[model samples]
Target: MTVARKRAILTADSVPMLPAHVRLIFNEKRDSWVVLAPEKILWPDDISVLILQNCDGARSIGEIARALSKEFSAPFSEILGDILEFLQDWSDRLLIRLAEQSGGKP
Candidate 1:
């Protein structure tokens, strides 16, 4: 997926996912995981991997942050900024596609 010239403003209701051509793979050769975007390959840190896994085009951004907060043992308010930053960065890189959410989904 290509990053749009006009980016979408992410919100609590936004659901993000990797484009079809983009994927996360365990690169045995590199001894690490990598995000293989159509334009480039990226090596992400552990926290990044967790963020990527959460972007399944289902969970909203708020839900994603809450889950991450639990996993990292941090308060949601404390981690929210960092989570937003990561999502925005990846979205700008076309590693994630954000969808508009109407309401909470089961």
Candidate 2:
């Protein structure tokens, strides 16, 4: 059976949280930074700082997920729903994109 894939749509109005508000605590021993937001965002553990960094309203979810899969050795096929779920949580928290302003239904 073939699974359906959702193509991520990019918009101009999607604004990521600013760097100042998002703080990173690097664990040199671990070689990864622990990103802390003033409040919780969705699935923070599943996403990395780089993934959030590139979500600058230009890259689509598919693009980011693909890159993340390559960089982090994650399965791209399984990450789509997870990405969408993250986007939904971020939307609820007003973190990632202004969904209504973006003009497309997810």
Candidate 3:
């Protein structure tokens, strides 16, 4: 038997909204870190929102893939691979936590 690894993902609609109590914002336009705790809102300039927000606690890889397919109008298989790659990069940076199923599946 092999061990399971957690995967990170987020939905397109929920991407603009951060979790309660958590604050995040980007400031490439001004070169700063804009944070709003207790009132999280996605900045229009924040591209990471699309890549990171799908990382909800229990959403599966397949679920995210379908959602992204509609959102980007791209092929499911391609979007799936792309999202996986994006998540891997974020995981390496410690930006988000990977979802771990009780069993051994992403």
Which candidate wins on TM-score?
A: 1
Full-model lDDT, candidate 3: 0.53
Ranking of predictions according to TM-score: 1, 3, 2
On lDDT, the leading prediction is 1
Over the stretch 20-43, how does candidate 2's per-residue lDDT look in tens digits? 454445667866666566775333
User: What's each prediction's clash count?
Assistant: 0, 0, 6
Tell me how many residue pairs clash in candidate 1: 0
Model 3, span 60-86: residue lDDT tens: 656777887898799998887766666
How far off is residue 87 in model 3, in Å?
0.6
- For candidate 1, lDDT tens digit of each residue in 23-79? 988999979999887779899998888888888888878999998898879999767
- Model 1, CA-based lDDT: 0.80
Q: Which stretches in model 3 have alpha-carbon errors above 4 Å?
A: 1-23, 26-47, 101-106
Give TM per candidate.
0.83, 0.50, 0.51
Candidate 3 has a TM-score of 0.51
Q: Of 1 and 3, which scores higher on lDDT?
A: 1
